[model samples]
Each structure stands twice: as structure tokens, then as C-alpha cells.
Target chain A: MSGEGWVAVVGTGPAGPEWLTPETAGILEQATDLVGYGPYLDRVAAGHQRRHASDNREELARAGHALDLAAEGAKVAVVSGGDPGVFAMGAAVLEAVDRDTAGRWRDVEVTVHPGVSAMQAAAARLGAPLGADFCAISLSDNLKPLAVVERRVRLAAEAGLVMALYNPASRARPWQLGRVLEVLGEVHPPQTPVIFATAAGRGDQERLTVTTLAEADPARADMRTLVLVGIPATRVLQRPDGTLRVYTPRYYEEAE
Target chain B: MSGEGWVAVVGTGPAGPEWLTPETAGILEQATDLVGYGPYLDRVAAGHQRRHASDNREELARAGHALDLAAEGAKVAVVSGGDPGVFAMGAAVLEAVDRDTAGRWRDVEVTVHPGVSAMQAAAARLGAPLGADFCAISLSDNLKPLAVVERRVRLAAEAGLVMALYNPASRARPWQLGRVLEVLGEVHPPQTPVIFATAAGRGDQERLTVTTLAEADPARADMRTLVLVGIPATRVLQRPDGTLRVYTPRYYEEAE
Candidate 1:
């Protein structure tokens, strides 16, 4: 268990196997050990790859373990549900690398492989809500202060940015999303289109709802949901089958 | 040729066939007709599918052509390089859907299948430059005014957001990216990490450069390049192999 050590951070994309990019899949297939949250680890097609699953909040520990294993000559795959770089395991691993003063972890070969992001998949399911200059903001506030999240939300909304909010709500933080809606309501009209897309591409387990900002029920969004808030240029088309297709136009008209 | 109308917008990621997501690949394979920019359409593995390739700026016409074909019972796919929704074809198709007053184009069953966005792939290649909350802004300013792009870029920089700037430079638009760097320089330190990733994942044509805001050579980037600007929190780890890995931490440390 002692040779050139390396770690690959992989994104599975929206909690399904088909979303795996070829590069990410290649890394996962060659992984001697896979580490991630329990739920995300379950989504990997682990063909004899040892699982190092941990709880949701144990990100740092999981990252350290992955780095340590890689340093011991293990081909480790630290998996994230969406794009690993987007508020996911890639950050945690890099943080561990920076802080590991006792080990030769800095020399460990680490790479991040891109995967389909939840916001990307969610926007796709709703047609194309992220068509304009958009921002992806994680509302969890676990990594930063709540005030900072609110400040960013307000600035983004004021800048006419269509936004995709990740980690909108969890059992421990159910009110943050509602607060975000309140902030958005101050700048955007109540008629602004918002989409609550959950478990996109998850087959039979998927749920999608399109509503106006005033009508959006924040309670409907759990940890799995990605909430897309549209800019003023966003439009919703009605299908013959009575479904709604939300998309932002590519061209932006000068604001009156 | 008359039946129910349908259109699927697909993303062929990073100018490489291997980056095609399974969902997007399936749509292209099943398409009776494929429509897109001349280069992007060429990437689709269209086996006997009718191709409706158009010049890059003819997005609306290409979208209209796809809709017309779909209206005639053809399973049509409007293709784009990178993610369709990110400064590409999805928004144009949606705009066409919204503006089509004469035909029943609004009723067509249109779906967007997400692909690995150029920013995502480029960030992966640079080792997670977008590891935290970030925004993607297209610097073309052809669709919108340069003032608007500058305003957003300034706001993003002032808010300490890591930014992925799409269409940063082109033969026709060489100075805009330099102007953007100037604006970012006003708010951020000249030492901020910047990545110039071009033709990412595109076989031997690929190139990657990591530099700082002060040293960033805007001339090195063209339309095919993706520019990622790091926030103050972004860290660069220099490997023994003489390469640098830039990543923004998951948790933001409180500024003194």
C-alpha cells in the first residue's frame, strides 16, 4: 500500500448513474476506494470498490480520509452528487490538502473531473431557466455566515441575475429559503417565474413545479430540490399537454 | 410528415464528442433532424439524420428551422457546443418559442438536455477554480451592451464572487476581456488567480494557462477560451510536477 498516491474527485450528477461523464466514470471504475456521504456513495456502481461513506456533515473528515488513503497508495474517488467543484467534495479535499502540515499530502496527485451539476439538470428539466447570466448560490450557510448569503442574494437579484439556489432547505435549516424568497421579493416582481425542480433525471422519483414568486411554497423544497429564480426576461410557455416550459431569452432588452 | 411537434436542445460539451452526456447523446441519436451552428452540428453523431447547420450568429433562424421541422413531425434536436443554456442555443430556441405568434410553435414539446458546460469542464481541468458559489457571465456584449456586462462584472467582483467568463475574447472582441480585467482589478488584488483554458477536452488542440490578474494575457484567450477569475479565498497549490491547482475553499474565512 505504498507507491505513487493520487485522488480523483468525481461528480455523479443529480444522483443517477447515467449522468456520469466518461472521465469521471473512468476514475470511479479504477477507484480502490470511494468516499462520500452515505446517500451519494450508494449511487456509485461500486464493483468491489471499498466504500468509505460518512454522514452529511462529516465533509472534512471524509476529505481527510480520502487524502490519507491516497497518500497510502490507494486510488481514491471522492464522489459528489453534482459537479464536484460546485459547493462539493473538491473544495473539501483541496482544503484538507492545504491544511495537512504533518503529511506529504501536498505532493499527492489530485484532480477534479467535471460532472453534470444539479442546477444544470434542473434547468434542463424546466426547459432552460438558466439561459441568461445566472448565478448559483448555495443557501445552506453552513460554510459562510447567513448575512453573507443574504447579501449575495440581494446583490445578485439587484443585478438582474437569474439564480439557481442549491441546498435550499434541510431538516436543520428550513427557514433560509423562505428568507431568500423574502429578499428576492423586494427586488423582483411577485409575478417573477420560479421553478422548484427536485431529483431531476431520477426517474419516477422526480418532481417539478413552476410557479410565480408570490406563489412559491418554500416548504416544498427540501435538501434534494434546486430552486431556479428567473430574471425579468424569463418566459413560460404553455405546452399543448398543459405543461409549463420556463426559459430566459438569449437577448436582453434594455431596462426601461 | 405531419404529427405531434417536438424539439430537444442538446449540449455537446467542450467541443469534444466524449463529453456528450448520455441523455444528450440519446436525444441526438433519436433525432430525425439536427439543427445547430455549422461546427456544433458536425459534432453530433447523426446517423442519417438530416442536418440543418447554420452560421454561428443565425441562432434564431436555426431555432426556427428546428421548430418548423419538428412541427412537421420530425424529432428535431438543436445542438450547441458546451451547455446549450450557457450563452448558446437553448435560450435562442426559447426566445423563438416565445416570439412565434403565427405558428403553434409555443405548443411544441421542447426539452433541454444538460451537457457538461465549458465552464464546468474548464474548472475541472484547472482543479476547481469554481469550487465555491460562482457566476457565469458572457463578455461578448453583442447581445447586450458592454455597459451591462461591465456593470455585472464590477458587481460580481465587488461582491467577491469567483467568476467564469464565457466568450471572453474573439477576433472581433479582443479588448473587452482586457477591460473586464481592469474592472476586476479595481476591486480585487492583482494577485487573484486567473485561468485561461482553451479548447478544453478537445484532443491536441487543448491549452491551459494559470496566471494572476496582473499577469493575465487576454490575447491568449479567444472565443474558444473560458476565463475563470478567482476570489480572495481561492488558493493555488503548486505540485512537484510544476503545475498549479487552483481551488476556492468550500468555507469562506471571515475577513479581518
Candidate 2:
């Protein structure tokens, strides 16, 4: 097996060590080379693997380097925080492989290793807000236009689907999340449940807040946070002990 | 912690034991009661834990029962085959807890443990169909109306979003998958990439087939299969060794 080339795109899942899956850990252990954003690469156990850590914007370049190494018969692993397929490196790696015109790069074996996505962590933390048909749209207009982003938000709301908004806000684009909230307010009621969970399941830094859309402050969210907006059927309950929980019902109303 | 009422909703991820996460495994090992569909409960290691396995159609009843066990101060674990939050039991449990009205159920603490969702497993197996903006809709009209399913399919295609379709077809509903495929053909080219993966990541009985929209047959998919349809940006590449791969580019196109 060593004679051929292979690359594993692995998701590190939640930030805490315990959240790491055994399958992903085992795949990283066998990696001869690890490539990813610096912090994600650091998550791989320090060993014989040569690390090619880079900045966040270098995903395409990093994927190329991983593919190049794999083509040379090295066992390469491209590490991405959370699930690689969801707004992560899996897409970049596959894009690189798909666009590779040379036969050498095409023959390199590639596989994506599934891990728990950040949305899953947020949903787990704040009860299940995504219990029905849903859509995930990145509010970041870095690649797509903001107009397109705005349209998707409206269309998703019109469809009454629970939505997970990725890249809701960054320091540079603090107003991005507010715009979506405004569109949501037009369609959903003020009491519609919205959850902001930052660095969820990451031990101490994690912060979870369940609130109504009207009460949700975009300033409370940053890059680390994932915002979940529930449909009209979503409900928030305050327990007798003052703790709050939110959930979307599995059944949609129909003619009985 | 032992005296307090608590329940852990665990997602068993893919079909095999090796795909199981350590955290979920540890929680299941400590459970005093296991509740889920019969097949899901069977995945739990048999021991002292009392099993309350039921049929698939009884999700709400099962969730209520799990909460009942937790309210009785038992270490209960409700296992879902995939990520509990994604069209599964996580919402059911939370909804049951929130609407109990008797107030006895609200105090039964619940936590959802994130695991790899079935869509993630399918995306991993077939490169990255979900690398960009995506939506997941259950094609099973058992709960929601079939018209809602058909409308969402058209709208999702109109939005140019990749789609992950769950419960595409069942033995009783053999014609359902065909309907969605027909809608997909209307919006997409006949050569649009489509993937059908059944019992993914399972050691055996796992099947993966990649075909275009025109070539795909609904007969190939069943209840266990997940269908992935790519957007316009998606591509299919044939390697020198003749293996086919499909992926969506991470970079969203800008108006030139």
C-alpha cells in the first residue's frame, strides 16, 4: 500500500480533545505529512509527520501541496477544524484534485474523513434547532456577492426552513449578521428562537445563549460563533429552575 | 451527578463499530437504559443497561419514554442512527421535554452528543458534493406533504444550492425518488453529478454508485441511501486509472 500515493482529508471535530474521534486520530497517526491552517495542523500529534501549516487564506495552496506530496507516494493528511466538508478544507482539496490536469496528480488517491460539524455541535449544545428541512449559507461575501447572500437568506426564510448561518460576523464585517437578522425579522415572529453558540464544546471558552430573534444582538457574535435560526414552529421554554431550552418540532402541521 | 436526572442523546454515526466516536461509546457504556429503534439499540453493547427498543415510527413515544426514564433519575441514553439533530430524535427529545406541561419533564437534563451525520458520511465517500452552500430535505412524505417536498426541490435547484436528500425512497414508496429525480432533471443538465451511497462506512454491505442525473435509477436507492445532487459549479473528473470523482469548487464565481 505504501508504494501508491494517498491523501486523507480529516476533520478535527470539536476543539476539545475528548471530542476528537478515534477514526480521525488513527488516520492522522499514519500521516507522513500534515497540511492545514496552522492551528489545525498543531492539533495533529507531534511525530514524524512533516507539517505544512499556513494562514487561513492559503487553503487552495495547502491542498495543492498535500496532493503533490501524496503523488510522490507520501501518506498525506489535510486537517480541517470541525467537519471538512462543511465550509472547510474538504472542498478545497477536492477542487484541487478535480482541476489537476496532469496524470501524476490525478492518480493520487484521496478520501474525506467525516467528523462532527460545528453546526452539529451548536445544535447539540442548544437542543436541536435543525430538526427539519434546513439550509446552510455562509454570510461571508468573500467569494460570493453580498446580494446573493441576501437573496438566499430571504428565500430560505420564505421556505420556512431552519437555517444555520456560518461566518455570521467577523470583526471586519460586523454588520453582515445584522442584515440577515433584519430579513429574518420580516418573515419570522419576534419570539422566534435563535441561538448563538461560540466555541461550543471547547471547554471554558464556549458560550451558549438562547434568545428570540428580536433580542439577538449581532455584537455578541464573532467569527467563532455559529447562529441557528429556528422556523415559526420552533419554541423556547424556560424551565422552573430558570434554565432555557429551545427545540423545533419534528412534525409539520397538516390537515388532520 | 448520579442522583440528578440526566439524559445523553448519542448519534452512532456510520453503520460500523469503528465509525463510533469514543465519547458516544463511553456514554453508551455508562447508560442504565438504552432507547432507540431496535436496530439502533442493537448497536449498543449489551450489558446491565435496560433496553427500551421500539419500532421506527414511534420516535415521539420513544423520546417521551426516554425523558420519563431520566425523570426517574436513571442514566439514560437515546441513540440515533445518524446525528440526532438532523431529521432524527434530538428534536423529538427536546420537544418532549419542552412541552411535557406537567413540569416534571423539564428538570430531566438533556445533552445531545454530536456524531458524524449520514450526509457527512456520504459526502466523504464521494469527494465533496457539499463543499459549497447546501440544503438537506427529507423526501419522505410520511410527515410533511409531498407538495412541500417537490417545491423545496425546485427552489433549492433554483438557488443553485447542492442538496442532500434523505429518505429518498422506501419499499412502500418506490415512486418517491423518481419524482425528485425528475425535478432535478428539469433544472440541471443530464450530466449533472449525482451520488447514491448506501450503508456508508460500514465494513461490508456498503455500496457506492456515482452516476449522472439522466443515468441514475431510483431503484438503486432505498431507505438507507443518501442522494447527493451537485450544483452548476460541480464537476466530474475521470482519472487516468478510470475511477470517477465528483466535487464542487470552494470558490464561488464572481461576475466578471
| Highest-DockQ candidate | 2
Stretches of candidate 1 exceeding 4 Å from the true structure: A1-4, A170-173, B1-5, B170-173
DockQ of 1: 0.70
lDDT of 1 by residue, A62-110 (tens): 8999988988889999989888989898888887877877766876888
lDDT of 1: 0.83
Off by over 4 Å in 2: A1-3, A170-173, A254-256, B170-173, B254-256
Each model's lDDT: 0.83, 0.82
| Deviation from native of the Cα of residue B155 in model 1, angstroms | 1.1
Task: For residues B152-249, write the lDDT of model 2, one tens digit per residue.
Answer: 78877867778899988855567878988899899888888889999888757778888889999988987789999887678776766676667787
**TM-scores, all models, native as reference:** 0.95, 0.95
Among all candidates shown, the one with the greatest lDDT: 1
DockQ of every predicted complex:
0.70, 0.71
